[model samples]
Each structure stands twice: as structure tokens, then as C-alpha cells.
Target: MSELYKKSLKQIRDLLANREVSVTEVVRACIERINTTNKQLNSLVYVAAEQALEQAEKMDKEGPQPDRALWGVPIAVKDCICTKDLPTTCCSRMLADFVPFYDAYVVERLKVNGAIVIGKTNMDEFAMGSSTESSYFGITKNPWNTKLIPGGSSGGSAVSVAAAQCFGALGTDTGGSVRQPASMCGCVGVKPTYGRVSRFGAIGFASSLDQVGLFASTTEDSAILLEAIAGLDERDSTCSTRPIEAYSQGLTGDLKGVKIGLPKEFWQAGGIASEVLGEAEKAIDAARALGAEIVDVDMPHIPLSVAAYYIIAPAEASTNLSKFDGARYGFRAEGVETLDELYEQSRTQGFGDEVKRRIMLGTYVLSSGYYDAYYKKASQVRRLIQQDYLAALQKCDLLLAPISPVTAWEIGKHSGDPLKNYLMDIFTVSLNLAGLPGVAIPAGLGVESGMPVGVQLLGRAFDEHNLLKAAHRLEQAIPSIGSPKL
Candidate 1:
């Protein structure tokens, strides 16, 4: 049999059932892979090798659990997701040394499904930046080209999967964090419909928009991981009580009658590259070959989504970050004479510039006189954006678009201009505001850049299963096009 690195969940489960390889060996192979590749990519922030082995020993000696698909499989997590034993830093100095007493609901679900937590990968500080440059820990370089960025927030998670540091990983998506980075690194990631996955214990960025996502090397791997972790939880008020389906079963379902719409406005955007446009056209052609009807759709209000997202996301961010004011939790000043000084000093010292900027912007937008002018208008615009998507869905089963205008860009290319970095998230944020599901899959390799370009598929609220199926079919239609330097 081939090494575990090349096998998917199906292969692993069969091996575990037959006892071809011990659970300990499977997890050990994962750890060894991390140790080998993480040095070059720096994707993993903390590796729980000992803990994984201990869990594996228990599973092997005792026996695998029944009905749990992920039993003994290895998984990594974005640093923003809290793990009982690991530090949930959000890649910020404020919580640099802080550890949570409990696990995030997603983490707990994965554990219950018998998955092994390999480690916590790096991310943007408080999930705030686009290029991962805003992370206090340091930026996660693109797996395709080390000089380029791996997108933001979930950057580390994408690189980890592409590097084969772990079989799969859990990431958070607010403004395309999961899908963008997954595209940048040539991996597959899905942002579930907002309330499909419980968010209890996940560090908040934008309360209404925040969601846990998944990263894997293939659609089947991603679906298997998502199946284990997705579902409603009473603990999270936002979690939906709807039944979760078998995400893996229909990923390869026939696309004969599937209707996928391509928004004309998305491709016509000024920033989209020619190679990217060609690749997306080819993906549509391949889907057509599979009998999917490609219809031209219009989302007239799509252009304004970025502006509205910037205002509302920051508004939510400001209020959420107010909890980290030095005295309550996280960092505290060493030499403060007064209580107010301690709160102000520690926060100012611990938070990175981008975080502080967003906080200030958020506070300003929601401020006394400015509230009606900026925040209120943005809220109205947010509604319009959601309506745009809702209306578009009436014409087609799902909408298709590009994840990013370009492939992985050089790390320092946009670092000098903070606004440039923020613009990178423009295409991704509106879906978060609407609480819709989006999936990123490798479509083709860029001709000029020789990197991967991702195609995004969006579905109606809570229609992740449909979204996954569309992306999975397109991915299979394309050949071995992605080649991230994992």
C-alpha cells in the first residue's frame, strides 16, 4: 500500500478497520511530515505531537470507535479556534500567552468524531488582515511561491494542508479568509453557511459574519472533515437546528441537470487578470461538458458589497475587541500607576497597528454623530448586497466567481500600503455579511505566475451541500493543475 500521505479518508478508514497500520503509525506519519515541511513553510504555530501520539495509542490499544468517520485521522486548526490544551492566540500579542479553559464547539465535535488534533497553525492577528502580514507572529508565505502571500486569517491552515503537514485543517472565514488563502495555496476550503457550524468558543472578529471553515487537499477530504465537524449546537445561539446531510456522498453526484450561474459583473471587474478569466472560462466549459447548464446572470449591486462590508465588519470588530482591554484578560501593563492607564497602555502595546486601525474605524463609524452617516448607510447597503445574491439565486442553482483577481502575489508587494492589503478581501467579504456559503477549489494553474487560481461557488443560505457538489464536480473535471510548493 502507498504511504498514508497519499491516501484519502476512505483509504485511511479501511486501513484502520483492517489494522493494516496502527493509529499511532498514521498520526506519527502526520507528525513526521509536519516536522519535515513546516521548517520551509512555517505553517504550524504549535504541533501537538505528544498529545496526538497519546490519543492514537489509546485508540489503537482500545480499538476505533463505531460510526465515527474521522477516527484516528490527523487534523490541524487555525490558531483562532480554541483548543483546551493549546494556546488560542489569534496570532496577536494581546493573547500571545493566553490559553482557553475549554475547546471551541468545532474542536469538540472533531474530537467526538475521533479525529486527532495535530496542532494550531498561525493566522492574522484577531483575523484582521488579507495577506497575513498583519499577524503579530509573522506572515505565512504562499506554498506556491515562498515570496508570495497565502491569503489572510486562515493563511497558515491553507499552507499546512498544501504542505502535507496535516491531512486537513479547520479555519475561520469572515471576509473570504478560508477560501482566499486556500486558493492562494492551491488547496480546497469551504466556508459553511453561517449558522450550519456552531461558533461557541471561536474568537470573535465580526459576530454576525464569522464562521468556521475547512481546508483539505481534495474535495473528498474536505467533505469528510466538514461532515465530522458541522451541525447545530444549542450552546451557540446562532447555530441552526436543521439536519446535517452526508456532505461526502453527493460531492461526486452527476451534474447533468445542475444549473450554475456566472455573474457577468464578477469577471468584468477591473482587477481580474486575463489568465484568471481564461481559467474560469475553461472551468465553466468543463462543467458544461459534464452537462451543467452555464447561464449568464446579473448581480447589479455586487460592486457595492466591498464598501458595505468594510464598514459593517469593522463596526462589529470594534465592539468585539473591546473585551481585550488589559485588565479583564490577555496582556496587561507591567508598570501602570492607575487602572485606566493599565487598560490603555497594555492594549496599545499588545495590539498590532492594523487591529488598532480597524478598531478605531469601527468605533468611529459607530460614534455619536457619525453613526447615522456611516454605520447606518453601510447597514442599508449590506441589505442590498444580500438581496443581490438572493435575487441571483432565483435564476440559477448557484453562482460562480473567482476567489481572487490574481494568483499568489509576492509577500512584500502590498505590505507597504495597508489599504492595498485590505482591498484583497473585497471580493470575499460580502458573502460573510449575507451569511451565505462559499467554497474554493483549485481550477487551473496561472500561465504567467505559475500559481493556482481558485474558482468560488456560492449557494443560498444553508445550501452548503449544493455548493460543495458544484465545486467538487469542477475540481474533478480539471486535471492536476495545482502545484503549491508544499
Candidate 2:
């Protein structure tokens, strides 16, 4: 039954339905794996052992329902995404004891689709860092090599899926959080279009950029989950009223006549790692072999994405986090004389260094005197970047690039420089600004490190179907790309 952990959600459902393996055994296996490896990697912040076993016990007695797509598969939640009974801290002390009153929209959908909740995964504190090293809970090590860092801020969710602690996991992506970690961990992860999935209960980072993302071993699994979660939501005003597509329905489909765009600017770079670039080129060649028409395209303003993301993401974060001042909710300070003291002390005491740093940065950019110089300039750059993508899409069906410049770096290798770590996210952040759909599918493992390398496929806004179909085609072409070493 060791093969159980490597099977896709579709395959898992089939095995359980045929009574070849029980849901109880599946849940038990995942629990055992988590117990064995979690201490080494710190992938999971909380394990829902009792809840998982109870749910599995119930499923074991009841025969599988044909309509339930993920019936019996266990999945973990990124701590930032609210779960009904689990603490949603976003991996920081500021909200250490905070439990949600309601599940995030994606979590609720997962439960209704019959996926058992396994645990909550760790993340960078308030989703600020590219490496999980910024997490207050400590860095999440790469599954391939324990010394290397898993990419963040969705590091724990990616680690959980890669480690087989769960069949798949849910994460939130503001910039490269989900895609970058999935790339580093040798897993397939998807970041849906902005507002594709409702963000009702997720702790806000960047109001406009944050979107719920998912991790799996194959494009098929990611597509299945995307279908269930993507839809119009009354809870999120920013959520589009556009109809959600069947992201999995077109699998086993070839990319014949599909136009794939390779952004020329992405290749000519000082920030890119040579090995990562070579793997991406190999992936593109394989896709080309499968009847895809490759064209060189450009998103000129993409270079400014990093600066724009840092400004906008934090600007929104500062305001969203203002609610955590120990006044009415969340973690409160032990002793304070006045309301002002309570607010300051509670925040100062509860927040981690990274969280405080981002808050200060956010406040600085949004301050009256600096507002035009920082926030407004970032907004203008964001518009140009989105326009760049829109123009490129006019020339192609879908766009392709690397999710991250390099494979997982050694944990803490980037100790003193936040700018260096932030630059690793350069390639993935533009899509967030463009409000487009993107997926990071494992291309192959690195030569020396043998860590995973992923190529990102992006689609026009709300056009997830095109992205998934292309991903499914390329995944089949790639070899030994699924199943993390962990």
C-alpha cells in the first residue's frame, strides 16, 4: 500500500470504490507518514488526527458515492486559509490562538466534495517571505534535502503534499507562494485566476493579489480541485461573476494546434539560475514535440513586477492587519494601562519580526508624504504589467515561463538579505498583478541536487480551462516528474 500515497486523487477514488483499499487505511497511512517525517521538516503546524480517523471510520462503513470526486482522500490546509476547527495563525504569534468561526470557501468545498481534512500546513509569517525561513514556526526544510528551504509563503502546504502527509493540500498565493514551493518540492501546484476562488475567510495579505491555490502530484489532481473551488461567490465582492469551467474535463487531450508563448524577456535574465533555465527549455522542447506551436513573446513591464508587488502587497497588508490591535479580537497583550498601550503592546508582543517588518514597510509606503512616490507608482507599474500580458495573449493561446529561478536553496542561505529572496519570486508575481491563471507543473529534477524544477504555464484571465489542458498535455510528456523524493 506504499503506492497509495503516490496515486493521484482520481486513482485513489477508483481504488477505494473497488474496495481494494479502505479509506481508513489511507488515512492511517497518511497519519503514520506525518508522524514519521513532520518533526524533520515542520511541514504541518497542526494534525487533525481525531477528526481524520473519525471521518475515515464513517467512510469505511458507507460505500463510496459515485458522484464524490475526492471521496476518502486526505488533504491539508495552509494555515492562512481558515479551517473551522483548526487554528489559522498564518504561522505567526500575532494570531497564535486564533480559531476561525467559518471555513474558507475552498475548505468548505473540499469537505463537501468528501476530502478528509488531515492538518494545517505552515507558511511565511503573514505570507511576506519567498523562503519559509521567515516563518515564526521556523523554516520548512525541502523534502529532497532536509537542509534546503522549501519555497514560501505556502511552504508548509507544498511540503505536506510533497512529503505525502496528505494526498494534496490547499494554499494561498499572493505572489509565488504556491507555485514556487511546488517547484522547489517537485510537485504540481496551481494558482487560479485572481478572484477565481473566493477569499472570504483567508487572512488578507494583498486584497487584489491573494488567491487560493492547490498542490498535487499531477495536473489532473490540481484540475479536479480547481473545478470544485472556482466559482462566483456572494461573500467576495471582487470575485467575478464569470462561469467556472471544467478544468479536468479536457485531460488526455493533446495540444495540437495550441499556441504556446515563450516570453523572451523571461529567458534573458541576471536573476535566473542556469540549471533551472536548462530544465525549462527541455520542458518546452518536449511540449513542442507534442504538436504545440511555440512562439516567442514579450511582457516588457514584467521587470517591474517585483517592486510593484512589494509595494502593493504590503500596502494592503498593513490596513488588513490593523484589525489585530488587541482591541476586540485575536491575541491580546497580558497587561496594558490604556487602549493605546493595549493596541501597541498587543501588536508588538504578538507579531513576529517579519510580520512587524512588513507592517512598517506597508505603513511607510502608504504614509501621506510617500503615498504618491510608492503606492501610486506601484499601481501605475501594475497597470503596465497587466497590459503587457494582455498584449502578449493576443499573440498566443497561453504563456510559459519558470516558476522560480532556482531549485530550493539551503535553508537560511539567504539569511541577511530580504531583497535576494524577493528576487527569486520575480517570474511568478506578474500574473498576480495581471489577475491571470497560472500552474506550476514539475518539469524534471535538477542534475546535482536532484530537487524538482517546475515550468509555469499561464492563461488569460479566468481562462483556467486552456491552462489545465496545456498542463495535462505537458505533464504526460515529462518523465519521473511526479512523486517527490520525500
Candidate 3:
């Protein structure tokens, strides 16, 4: 990777602001790096080389302003987020020819702040799968070890940052999509509080669960990006009207007097690999050494999180995705005459297997006969899960846990059993269910594959400042793992 690609967004921004490097050089270097490595990693599905260059030249001609947070920085956005010109395929045939006429709120923020959108990264179809293999565009490979799978559905976004294809990227995290992929890729990924970031333009999988997430080289970079994109948007009713905090100012790395909650459920969860657990321990020890107090907290209802999440998310997904019927937009079956047949044939042909599976499961749960028994029950359980975290947080500032039970697994490791893939999400789905903020940072290398293992720091709703501060503190103690050689 070129040194230009290796630099953080902050570093790149500073260089561009000072005219130390032209915006054209920075963007062209990023595109060149993506071209060289993307064939192997399959991280980026689309590259708007001409448009990005055009923007770069425009930015170069107009001198950078001191007030813009991300002036002249190059960033990649996940394919699921709506981009005005770039094809937002979501790595699925369902939206193969789809292109939004306007940008997603986050994309609009990036552009207005002078950040260049190099391209759209790949992702699971409609953000439904834990591995990127479910995408119609083909699987995205782990940069650490090509044979291993990069966790999804934000796998491409993670790989783009890890491989230095872009300084940072935007991804949507419905469950652990952003954090899991960041963990496997050894980068920093953060999902803000549910309504903290506007969701106006992103293609929805599960409307209640989805949030625009940030992937960056460090927590501080994530904070900078988050600060720029997070705020009230009149377009999205779900977006919080609360005043946005200055998140970057909170990164003092002073853990003094901070209480870190260690949940019993996370550590005792079955199938948590020993190496990942050990890395979590090291992070706890590092926090303790920095004057933070570790407290034992109980979240008895956490085991029910995955069960509730699957029900709630899929149900929302079914409703949100219902608009894609042949009559509106996206793919439409050519030969179908009847409306029902067109809807059936288009969906059957447009969607991949994983997407269809979730849609069916969602449809079943929402069916009249089973609605109360399944979806209603799951909704009730979800409230309990949220309450569990609320109660636990009362005793501590934030919760600490392993991002995943294991490191990146080999491709096709759990392909035979869909339930096994769901099991992998046990640690992550709960946070989304609770509508809290969680940041995943690399703890260290694991014992088995020598790949990166990450730990999550989850905080209260709308309190991403605390999570980013704690994460940045822990990040300073751990050695930086450089970009993988392709």
C-alpha cells in the first residue's frame, strides 16, 4: 500500500488543508491503490474514478477552508447507502440497474464537508448475512488471510479501510454488520446510537435496527467522521432532534474515575474462543492500569437477544423491502403478465438465497395466524433485552465485551448450517436490539490464525463520546497492526 493510502483521514485532511499534497494526488493514489488490491479482495464493487477526479480537481482549484472537518479526504461508502450517480446495488441483482437521483443523508454530509467519495463498497444482499458470500456480486475476501471470510454485511467497507483502499468508509450496521467485519479486518468500526445518525437515504433492511456506521483507521478518525455526519435531519423522522455533541473534544484517553462494566453473560457465553477471551482480558487490564475501575455486571436476559433480534429485524425487513415489487422500481420480470406473478418472479430471480430465506421467515412471523405468537412475543422480549442493558449500565459507565466469539473463520466454514451463522452473532446483535452505541477496536492478534481479534465498548443511547473515549484509550495501549500485504 502507498503511504498515502496508509494515512488516516485526519492526516490526509491536514495534508490537503496545508497544500502539502494536492487533493488530486490523494484521490488518485486511493483509486490506484484500490485498482491494485480490489481484484484480490473484491472489496469495492464500483469505482467512480472520473467523478472522483473531477471533484478532486474542483476542490484543488478552490482552496481548503479551515472550518470544514473533512476537507479533501477520500472516503468509500457502502453500496447499500444511496449515491446519486454510483450504482447502489447492495451487491444484489435486485438493484443491479438502480441508481438514486439524490444522495443518502450521510453521503450528502461527506460531500458538503469536502470529502471525496471514491466509490461504493460491496456488502451482503440487503445487509442480511453475516458473511459477504451471500452477495450476488461474489464474496469479499479477508485482507488478513485471503482464505478466511471477512464478516459482513459491512465486509467490503471493513476491507476497504484495512487494505488502505480508502482513508475511511461508511457502512450501515443493523446488527453487528460494521463491528464484526471491522473486528475480522483489524480496523475500527462504530455504530452510533440508533437515531444519532440520520438514515434518510440508505436502503433499509430492518428500519428499526439499521444505523449508519463509520469505519476508520482509529477511534479518533471515526469520531471526526461521526461528528460530521451525525445530527438532526428533517427528512428522517427517526433521527434524533437532540443537539449534537462535539465528540472529537472528548478523546482525552483519561480513563480516570471511569467504571467499565464486565458482563458475566458475554464472558460465559458458549463457543467464545479462548484467544479472543484472552485478548478481552488484556484490554480490561489495560483499562484498569489507566485508572479505570472494572465492575461485574449481570445481564441475565442477554442470551435471549439473538432470538429477539432475528424476529424483530426480519419482520421489519419484510415490511421495508416490500416496496421493491415489480411495479415501482428496481428489477422487474420481463415476461410476467399478472401482478402477482411479476412480484413473485422478480423477487425470486432478483434476490439471492439468503435474502429470500430472511424474507420468508419475516413473512411467516408477520402472517396473521402467527403474528401475536411470534412477532409480538419477540417485540416484548426485545424490550426486556433493552431493559437488561439499561439496568446493567446503571452500575457502570459502559459495557465491555468481545466483538465476536471467534476470529475470522475460513471461507465456507459455516456454509452448511444457517443457524451456525446466527450463533456467530450472539455477542453483537444485542447492542442493536438495545439501541445503544458500540465501538469495536482491535484488541490484538488471536492464537489460532494469528488474525486480529477485537473487543467492543458499548455505551448508553446517544453517548458515543464515552465509547469513543474508552476505545481510543484502549487503542493507545495496543500496538498498531499495519495494513496487510496483498
Candidate 4:
């Protein structure tokens, strides 16, 4: 493996700018890394070696341009994110051969800024499961321990960065998919504020909750990628019109006068592991040592977050995914004599168990009679969750909490019981429910398994700037465990 594989996104950009390394070198190094490790980790669903190297060669001929923020950086995108020519299968048999015609908004931005898309990382089938095991392509093993599972649906994205296959990768967070996976893989993952980045070409998981997420080795990389992709998009109605922040630069790593909030409800919440909580407390102390005040706040409705998220997300997914009926595109079942049978046979054959389960749950909740009872009730609860976050954010600069209930679990530990896996997301789903920005930073190693433990800092809408700052400070105070040696 080349040393270039281990460089941070910022380092790669600087090297490219100074002509210390050619764009082809960086892209080839990453492709080589992916080729070397991807077999065991199953991180990448597709590797665009020829395309990436070709693009890098073109960039080398053109020379470096100071104006391009991510010029010549090699990055992998989650398979869920559309790449114009590459397959965007979402790791599902349903879209086994689905290659999109246009790039996702984030992908377009990366290309425009001269970032080479090395490949598409694996993900849960339609981004439904807590573990990447749900991916039709196969589970993505944790780089820290191949026996352990990488959290999903962005497990491959997290693993790609953690294993040094790429400087950074794009993931989507519907309910902690990005942050939780980053935490498990011991990398920096940021789920931007809901409208901070557009969702134009991302295959919808939960339309309202899904947001393009960033994964990198350092917080600065997260900030840089976020800046490169975030902004108003005429293509997406949900995208905000707010001006993008200069997130990569001007990061002081000082938290003086910053008020970090610890929600009482989070402390009292069920399922959070002791090590995870300890990590969050240590982060709090670290912030205090940096002159940031710690304040206790209440998010009374947080306990209902997971319940509400499942209902709302699945409901939206049921509706959003209805278009994949096998008639228009993607995998279509043969020998279907009628349209109804075709729809039934195609979906049954195309979708994995987890995807079917969610679709059924979603369809049931949205069904006429239950819509008023389940869907409406969940919507109201979702509002309360949002209000809880809004109220808590008013009391502090940002909210501090664990990214997941526990560290990465051994693969197949919860495979038999999907509900047990959902419980793993207790700490993460609430942020998505509230539509808030969150950055998960690796805090320490687990006592039992020596796996990575992460604590997240949640901020108000469009407050990624400060969230990254506080996270950087915590990162500095609490030493990282470093990358896994594959």
C-alpha cells in the first residue's frame, strides 16, 4: 500500500497543489488500496479504476488550479449516491444493474471541484438496516476487526476511509447511518443540517430524513467536504438558500466561551453502553478544560425518538420506493403474466428481507385506516422530537451525546433479530428525527472488545461550523486510537 492512502483529505489537496504528487498517483494509490483491502472488508460495491485514473490523468494534464477546493482528491461515494456513468445500485438486487443518467448533486459538486470518484461504497439494501449485512452485495467487515460488523447503511463508506482506501467518502444519513458507521469504524462522520446539502440524486431511503453525509479521517476533512457539497440547489426544494460557510479554513480548535449541553434524557435513555456514556463524559470534561462551559439541558421527548423515526422513515420509504416496480428500470422478474403479478414477483425477488420488512411496515402505516392512527401519530411525535431538540439547542451552543448505544458488534450477533439491531441506533436516530446537524468523533476504545467508541456533538440547523470546531477540540483532548492496520 502507498503512503498516499493514509494522507488526510487536506494533505492530499496540499500535495496536489504543490506538485509534490501527481493526481494520477493519488488516484492510483487509492485504487490500489481498495483492491488490496476490499476483498476482505467488502467496502466497495464497485471500483471505477479505469474511469478514476483517466480523470486523474486529465487533471494532471490540466495542472493544479487553486480555485478548486477538492482538486484531484480521490473520494468514494456511497452506492446510494448517483454517479452519471457508474452503477448506483444501492447494494440491492432491485437495482442490480441500475446506472443513473445524472450525478447526484453532491457528486456533481465533487467533480466540479476536481475530486475524482474512485468507486461506490457498499450500503444496506435501500439504506434500511443498522448493519451493512443487509446489503445484497454482502456485509462490510469492520477494519478494526474483520470478525466484527461495520455499522450501516454507510458501513462501506466508513470502512473505506478508516482503512485508508480513500481520503473521504460520501454517505447518507437517514437515521444515524453515517455517524454510527463512522463511530464504529473510528473515523469522522458528519451529517449536515437537513437542508444544508441537496438530495437531488440520492436514491431516497426516507425522503425527509435522508441527508448526504461526509466521512473522513479528520474533522477538518469533514468540514472541507461539507463545504464543497453544501449550498442551495435549484433541483431540490428542501435545500436551503443559506450561504455556505467557509468550513475548512479558519478552524481554530478553540472552544472558549462555547456552551456544550448534555441532555438529561440522553443520560437516562435506555440501551446506551457504559463505555459510550463514559466517552461522552470525557468529551465534556475535555471541552471544559478548553474553557467551554458545560450545561445540563432537557430533551424530554427524546425517549420517543426511535419509535417516531421508524414510523416516519418507513412510511416515507414505502411511498418513495414505490417507483421501483420493475417496469421502468432495474431488475425485473421474468415470467410474470400480469402487471399485478409482475409487481409482486419483482419486489419479492428484488428486495432483501430488511427492505421488504420496512416497505411492508411503511405501506401498512400509510394504508388508509392506519394512516390517521399510526402515521399521523408518528408525525406528531416527530414534531415533538424536533421541538425537544430546538428547545435544548436554545440552552447551549450544541448538544453532546454518544453516537451509538455500544461499540461495533460481532458480525451475525444480531442477525436473527432485527429489533435488537434497531436498538443499537437509540443514540443516533433522534438527531435525524430532529433534522439537526451532528458530527461523531472517535473518543476511545471499548473495554471489552477494544473496538472504537464515539461521542457525537449535535448542533442547531446550519451550525456545522461550530459543531466541527467543538468536535475538533474534543478530538485534540481525547487522543484517537488511530486507523486499523488491514
TM-scores, all candidates, are: 0.97, 0.97, 0.98, 0.98
Clashes (candidate 3): 0
Return the TM-score for candidate 3, rounded to 2 decimals: 0.98
| TM-score, predicted candidate 4 vs. hidden true structure | 0.98
Q: Record all residue pairs in model 1 with backbone atoms less than 3 Å apart, i.e. clashing.
A: none
TM-score of 2: 0.97
On lDDT, the leading prediction is 3
User: Candidate 2 clashing pairs?
Assistant: none
- Cα lDDT tens digits, model 1, 1-486, are 445766666678678767888899899888888877787777888889999999999999988666788888889999999999788899999998988999999999999988899999888889987777777777787777888888878899998888877788999999999999888888899999989999998999999989999999888888888888888788999899899988888677667988888887787778888888877788888889989988988877778877888888889999999999888789997989998998899989999988999999999999999998989998888888888899889888998889888888887787667777777776788788789999898888888888888888899987877878888888888886644545
Give the root-mean-square deviation of each candidate in angstroms.
1.3, 1.3, 1.1, 1.2
* lDDT of candidate 4 at residue 163, scale 0 to 100: 95
Q: What ranges in model 1 sit over 4 Å off?
A: 482-486
Model 4 per-residue lDDT tens digits across residues 1-486: 258987889989999999999999998888888889999999999999999889889989999998999999989999989999899999999998999999999999998888999889999899898789999898899999999889998999999999999999999999999999999999999999999999999999898899999999999899999999998899999999989989877776578888888898887777677777776677788888999988889888888887888889889999898998999997799998999999999999999999889999999999989998889999899899899899888888998888888888888899878778877778889888888999999988887778998888999999899889888877888877977988
The per-residue C-alpha lDDT of model 2 at residue 188 equals 85
* Model 4, residue pairs in steric clash: none
Q: For candidate 1, what is the total of clashing residue pairs? A: 0
Could you give candidate 3's per-residue lDDT for residues 1-486 as a string of tens digits? 256887888888888889999989999899889889999999999998999999889988988877988988989999999999789998889899999899999999998888889989989888988889888888999999999989999999999999999999999999999999999999999999999999999999998899999899899999999999998998999999999888888687579999999999998887889989887788899899989999989999899888888888889988888888877888998988899999999998888888888889999999999999999999999889899999989989999998889999989999868888998999999999988999999988887778889999999999898889889988998777666777
Candidate 3: worst-modelled 10 consecutive residues by lDDT: 477-486
